[model samples]
Target: MTESGTLYVVATPIGNLGDITQRAISTLQLVDAIAAEDTRHTVGLLRHLGISKPLLAVHEHNEQQSAQGLIKRLQAGESIALVTDAGTPAVSDPGALVVQGVRQAGLAVVPIPGVSAVITALSAAGIVQPGFYFEGFLPASGSQRRKRLEILKTLPTTLVFYEAPHRIVECVTDLAAVLGGHRQLTLARELTKTFETIHTCGLAEAVAWLQADPNQQRGEFVLLVHADVQEKAEGLDDETLRILQRLLQELPLKQAVALATDITGQKKNELYEAALAFKAANTHE
Candidate 1:
C-alpha cells in the first residue's frame, strides 16, 4: 500500500525571481507534480531556477475539476505542489478549493509563505499599527465599487486593496469620492519590479500625482488607505472648515453636514454642530 503524500501550497515571487524562498525551490523540485495557475508562466520560473517537474493547469476556469485530479494523485502517494504565477497560492488567486478538498480527504496541507503584495505595501505604508483589512481587488463596475467603498469607509483599521492598471485611475477617483480627500493613502505600484514606486500622500494629492503622469497608472497597484480617525472638537483644519462653509451655501444644512462627514471622515454629529455654529456666527456677522 502506497503512503498518502502531502499537498504543499508554495509561494512564488511576485516580480523579482530572487524573492522566492529556498524551501519553495526545494519543494518544487521534490514534489511529484506541480499544480499551477498558469503552466506557461510557472515554466519560465522553473527554468530560471533550473528545476523541472510535471505541470498541471489549475486555473480559475477549471480549478474544481483540477483539484479533484490533484487529490486523487495525492491519495495515490504522489506529493503535489500548488503555485500561482506569483505570491501565495489560493490568496486572491486559486487553490482554496484544492486546499479544502485535500484536507477534507485527510491529506496534509503545508504552507510555504513568501512575499505578498498586500503585506509588502502595508509594511512601507508607515501605518503605525499592525491591524489592517485586506479587501483584494475591488468590484469592476463604478457603482458596485462605490457601494463596496462606502461599506469599507467606516472601518477603524487600515484598508488595503489590489487594482489593475486600467482601473486604477477610476479606483482612486472613487476612493476620493467615498472616503474623502482628507484621508491619507499609500500607493504601491509595480512592487518589487523595476520602476516600482511607493508613495504616501493625502487622497487628493495622490489623485493629482497620478493624473500628472500617465506612466504612474501603468503597473499593478496596492492601495492602503489610513484608518478612520476620531478627532477633537476643533480638529477640522482651516481648509476643511472652508469646504464645509462653501458646501453650506448651496446645500441644505443636513446635506452639507453629511457631505462634510463623508469628505472629512469625521463624526456626523460633530460636523453638524460645527456647521450650525458656523451658520449662527455668520448670521450674527
Candidate 2:
C-alpha cells in the first residue's frame, strides 16, 4: 500500500469451520478492521476464532457507501480485511467493490485463499479437464433459468453451476430435457459437511434420486454437466456399422470407434464385436 494501509481478502469455510487456512487466521488477527458481506455471519466466524475487530457491512445494496468508508480506513493507515460468509470473497460473492476500490486508492489487496466450493467440487469430478465453464447459480426464475441452461447447451466442454438446495431437483429435470438424459453428470451436495454426498449418474437418474430423498432438498450444491455426445455424432443407425469398420482400417482406432458409435446407436461393445468379426472374416478370405 502506498501509505502503509493494506486490504486482505480472506476466505472463510463453506460449511465446516476447520477449513480455514493458518495464513487466513494470521491475516485476520493482523488486520485493523474487517469488511464482511454479512455482519452476523462474520461475527459468528470471528467468535469461533476468538477474534474481535471493527467490522463494517459491505453488501451489494450499499457497496458504494461501504467503499468510501473502507477507503478512509485505509487512508488512516488502518489495515483492512474483506471476507464473505463462505468461500473466497468476490467470486459470485461480496468483496468485489472493497477489493476493487482499495486497489484504485493505491492500496495493496492481499488474498488469503482457502477452500472454494467450486474448486472443491471440480477436484472430485472424474471428468478430464480441458476447459470448463463455471455457471455460478442459475437465474431463479423458471423461464429465465431454463433459458440460461439452453444457452449453455451447445458448449462442448465440462460445465459447472452452483445451485440452491431447494431448486436443484427442478434444475436437474430441466437439465435432463435440455441437455438430454444420456449425458454424464455429477452432483455434489452439502460439501465437507457430515452428510456430504457426491454422485455421478445419467441426468435422469440424478433427478429421481433427489426426488426420493426429502433431506436432499437442503444444503449447498454444485453440479457438473459433461458435454452432450457432440453434434457430429448426434444420430446414427445400425446399418452404418459395417461401413464404419471398413473406414477404421486406415484410421486410428479411437477416432474410428467414436465415429462408428456416433453413427450407430449400437453399443460400443456390439460395434467392437462387429469389428472383430469383420477382421476375422477378412483374414479368413
Candidate 3:
C-alpha cells in the first residue's frame, strides 16, 4: 500500500501572471495532480508556466463528491495541489471541503498563501485599519442584502466585500442607500492587472462615479466601506431608516414609526420625525 501524501492549498495570483509566487509554482510542478475550481482556467495557467500536470474539476457544485475522490488519491500517496482560477482557494471559492477531508483522513494540509483580494484592496484603501471585516459577496436579493448590510452597519471595523461586474453598480447603489450617502468607501477593480483602478470616495458620489464611466462597471471588484464614525440620525441606522420609509408606503406615519421603533430599538418620536423626512424626500424624487 502506498503511503499518504500531503495536500497543498496553493494561492495563485488574482491578476498579473508574474505575481504568482515561486513556491506556488514549484509546488504545482511537484504535485501529482491539481484540484482546480475550473480545469480549463488552471490548464491555461499551467500552459503559461510550461508545467503540465493532471487537473481535476472541484468547483462549488461538485466539491463534496470531488473531495472524496481527492482524499482517496491523497491517501494513496499522490500529493495534490488545490488552486482556484484566481487568488486563494476555500475563500469564497472551492477547496475547503477537500482540505477538511484530507485532514480528517490523517493527511497533511499545507497553505501556500500569496495574494488575496481582501488584503490586496485593504492595503491600498488608505482607511484607518486597526481592524476590518471581510463579508465577501453580499446576497443577491435586495431585501436579504439590506438585512445583511444592516448587521454590518454598526461594526466599527472596515468592511470588505467581493462583487462581480454585472451587479457592482447595483451593489454600490444599495451600499450608498443603506450605509448612508456620506460614508466613505473604496472600490478596487481589477487589482494587479492592466487597467486596474482603485478609488476612495463618499458613498453618495460612488453611484455617479461608477455611472460616469461605462468601463468602471466591468471586471472583478473588491469594495471596502469605512466603519461607522458616529451614531446616525435619531440613533437609527440607514437600514432602519430604509425599513421605516418602506413601512410608510403602506402604513400610517404613526404606525410606521411604531414598527420602525420596535424593529430598530430607536425612540418612536425620533422615528416618526425621520419617517416624515424620508417620505417627503422620496416623494420629491
lDDT of 1 by residue, 147-251 (tens): 999999888778899999999989999998898775667899999999899887667667789989999988889999876442323677757765676687678
TM-score of each: 0.81, 0.81, 0.80
Backbone clashes in model 3, listed as residue pairs = none
lDDT of 3 by residue, 1-285 (tens): 112388889999999999899999999888988899999999989999999999999999999999999888887889888999999999988888888888888888889999998998888876644788899999998889989998898786778999999999889999988888746678999999998999876677798999999999999999998765434345777667657656776788888888788888988777776765544333211
How well is each residue in 128-212 modelled by candidate 2, as lDDT tens digits? 6357899888888888888988899989777899898878888888888788665657888899999998877667578888888
Worst lDDT 10-window in candidate 3: 276-285
Q: What is the lDDT of candidate 2?
A: 0.77
Model 1 score (lDDT):
0.83
Over 4 Å off, model 3 = 1-4, 232-285
Clash count for candidate 2 is 1
The CA root-mean-square deviation of candidate 3, after full C-alpha superposition on the true structure, stands at 10.1
Better of 2 and 3 by TM-score: 2
Clashes in model 1: which pairs?
none
